[model samples]
Target: MQSQNELRNLLQRIDHKSYPAYKDTRGSYDFGNYVLSIDHVQGDPFAAPSKVSVHVRGGAAKFPADLYRMKCRRLAVCDYLLRQFGQELERVSFKAKGSGKSGLLAVSRPGQEVLERTACQMDEAKGDLVLRFEVGFPANGRTVNARELEKIFFTFLPECVSHSLFYKALDEKAVYRAADLAEDQQYIRDHLKEQGLVAFVADASILPRESGVSGRPMKDAVKFTAPESMKVSFALPHAGKIQGMGIKKGITLIVGGGYHGKSTLLKALELGVYNHIAGDGREYVITDDTAMKIRAEDGRSIKKVDISMFINDLPNGKDTSAFRTEDASGSTSQAANVVEAMEAGAETFLIDEDTSATNFMIRDELMQRVVNREDEPITPFIDRIRELYEQYGISTILVAGSSGSYFHVADCIVQMNRYKPQEITAFAKEEADRFPLPEVKPPKQAAPTFERAVRPDRAFKEDARMKLKTMGRDGISINRDTIDVRYVEQLADTEQLAALAYFLKYAEIHVFNGKRTLRESVSLLMQYVEEHGLAAVTESSYVPCGLAMPRAQEIFACINRYRRISL
Candidate 1:
């Protein structure tokens, strides 16, 4: 350990030396109020920024214990502090600057929701708060600028720490309010099934986006109001007596014309797995965490999945049970996705016809008449949807515009017209009774069992070095293979991707074995994360600063997509 003055002197001694000289500055320094640690140094100015952390004792910061007494509340405080630190960094203009990435400071950037992250952590047992961030470490071309580096360490950082860490410098009410909102959202989600609902959208919530590509709420979007038939209310701990449209746990349909908010409402429901910020328009919208969005992914890989429930009797003698395909058709892929979701413990399915396979969704009377039941290999989802709910307790919320065949099986129906939902289950039932289709025979086989053997050839060596990198939000490159997750709609943030990449590598090293199934391995990986926090995934010497928690479902999907899997 060294004093701040001594660290400054070391930086001065390394000035104008080769870039490798910056390595000597990697050590802990006592800065009175906080202890600063430069855990890792960048090899070059153009390389990734240096890893740094600041630790402030609990007594110095004076934060209330209640703020972190609960896991959800603690995460909220960590998110708030990260935002405050980012704001402080934006306010400061460094006096010394040089080449690429010089004089820049950054923490993990947050999305619309607050998540458990490694960027900031509070250890109540140790009575300390640790904030991890990245610094460029000022440089002149390839040479170090010791004077500018001293200013960053001794001057700029202390101000950021003071304003962001101390309870007095922050708006206490705002922080508490954010935590309360997060808690209330969790409470609502926890009670959704108890209330006999699959999803809930609060009254006055905005469901429209700024654009098709943008996730931000529209400026003049219509406020949501529940129809009298579907409107339900819940009394939460922090937020008392909130009213919303509670989608019941059964086969439900949303039907309307084009551009009439059918997809928008479903989008909100899909995203409801996460608790939004207070002013995020859909803050009170909550759904089951196990709810997975089902869609057609034609090019995705399927490994040893039991999609035989929906697909069987191929043209050739291709077995649907223990199915393995490198490139699946649209209908086959959708069926596999649903089965995989079920294997991973998905309780509810959210589907939109726009993104679904036309033939897989429904085969009407005309098509059934043209092709005999014995001749057709596919069983439309409409026939099995009711059976899925009644037998398995699995619920489905589907958006359908072209087909009324689903009306026969639907327990609830809501029409979205001009951005407003209307309960039309009665109307839909009457229409179905007036013009019913031919009675269809149920499939012969029972639900297929999901089982797969771990491939012994895919074993990961303990001493082997492997690298992981995130390719946008939907893909991760691990060693030589690229895991495609483009159809995984639940992965909302890049931080989650980064964390997932680390978890995959971590799983390969620690959890994978020939004895454990992929699902079992993923469960063990999640259990490890639960016990050790997100930092456990990273092997870097410095604390991992940008990791966010991802659901076990997504992690399982990632592992299944790896082409190296053997049945």
Candidate 2:
């Protein structure tokens, strides 16, 4: 490694040279406290910024062992550190002056949810904590402004590393608090199965957001309070005794009038699969980690899936057991989504009627009479929800504003009136008893073996590589094929979508074999992730900082949505 002073001398020599002179700086420099590695240099100042990383020795960083002792706590600490470093970068960004994005600095910005990201990583056993980010190399109209870049490297970056990476320089109480909160969150998850709960929403949690456009908590909004009958208490290590509503593992229905917060509550449950940062509101709201938000995705392609449990007997006589379609109806797509969720090992389903197919969700008495059972092909979710829970142990939390057909099958019902939830299971059951539910057919099949093979579509099999990129959080572009995930409601970030693309790239090259099932292939890939890290998916020598780890559910969702995957 070159000494910092030697780097300064090189920058002085390269001053006023062509922009390509910056490439000479792409290597490791030994600063006093940390090692700076410039992994990739950008040729143009306006292009994507140069990739860089800082490695701080454990002896100098001085973080506690317990902070990274467990995988969960390590993720929490890493997230917190990334936020801190992001703030520091913003503080010093563009301090040095030049043209065309010169002297700009940035790291991956996080949102309300706390997800594992490659922006920050700590390996105590390896004796280093690394943080990766991007920086705009200083340039003045296609000429190198090496002195300005030198100031950023020797001055601004040192301050960021000192304040953000070193635990001693940070607020000790806040750091420990973040780590402890992770433990408490993990405690809730560890006990949920034993307590027969699929989700928990802490009392006084602010469930409403500031607006449809913002994820921040609403100011002066009504704080959520659970009905006394449904309130459950837990003794957390840090927060002590806390009371909340425990949603048991079974079929649950959320019913209410329009604009009465039914969808709001379900929306909270939808994102509860992730741990949130402090002051984000709904921090205590935790759902089954494997919970998936199911919605109707019309026109999406479905490659070989067994959706017969909810959909069968198509008029076209297309086999429902191994269903395939390039353009699926809403009902067919919804059924395929549920089946795909099951194949991904989702333990719970979170559905909102607004995004679901009407015919797939319920079939009313009048509709059943008008459309005879023989003519109808779809079984509807209302008839088979009970079996989903009782036979398969899959829990469903559904939001419905216009229908009461779900009341008969629901083990618990919660009414959201004016932004407040009240237990109404008994009352709803009484109403349903007065008008008995009509008989419906049982599930046509048992639990699936979940063996779906993935082969490239015939048109693309001959191509050597795919041009894959994430289209924000809504879709991924693989070659010319588009995998729309706009209705996969649980996807929270574009970073996660990017990671999914990388995972698919990695799988296409290594994991997928002729015999391995989709489930088996994902399991093997997950093992690699557990052993290595998300950056490993890039298959690069340098660690990338842009990717945020996605749950296996989203990975399955990615493959399921890709149009180029053949049966």
Name the best candidate (by lDDT). Answer: 2
- Tens digit of per-residue lDDT, candidate 2, span 1-567: 989888999899999999998999989999988999999999998888899999999888888888887777787888889999999999999998898889899999998988888888888474368899999999999999998998899889999989899988898888877778888888898889998999999999999999997889999989999989889989998899989999999999999999989999999999999888788778899899999999998899998898888877788888888888999989999999998999899999999989999999988888889989878888888887888888878999999888888888888999999899999999999998988878876646756558887664444345536677888878988777778988878888888988898788888777776578899888998999988878888887787778998999999998888876654
Residue 554, candidate 1: Cα error in Å is: 0.6
**Segments of candidate 1 deviating more than 4 angstroms:** 93-95, 124-127, 456-459
Q: In candidate 1, how many Å is residue 108 off?
A: 1.5
Tens digits of per-residue lDDT, candidate 1, 1-567, equal 799989988988998888889899889999998899998899988899888999888888778888877777778888888888888877764454877777878888777777878888887554478999888888888888877888888889889899889888999999899888888898999899888998999999999988876777899889999999998998988889999899999999999999999999999998899888877799988989899999999988898888888989999889898888999999999999888888888899999999999888888888889988889888888878888898888999999998888888899999999999999999899989987978887786778685665553344564446667888787888777788888888888878888888887777677776678777887888888888778987877777787888888888787778776554
Candidate 2 stretches greater than 4 Å from native: 124-127, 456-466
Query: In model 2, what lDDT does residue 437 have?
Result: 71
Residues forming the 10-long window of minimal summed lDDT in candidate 1: 455-464
Indicate the residue-level lDDT of 3 in model 2. 91
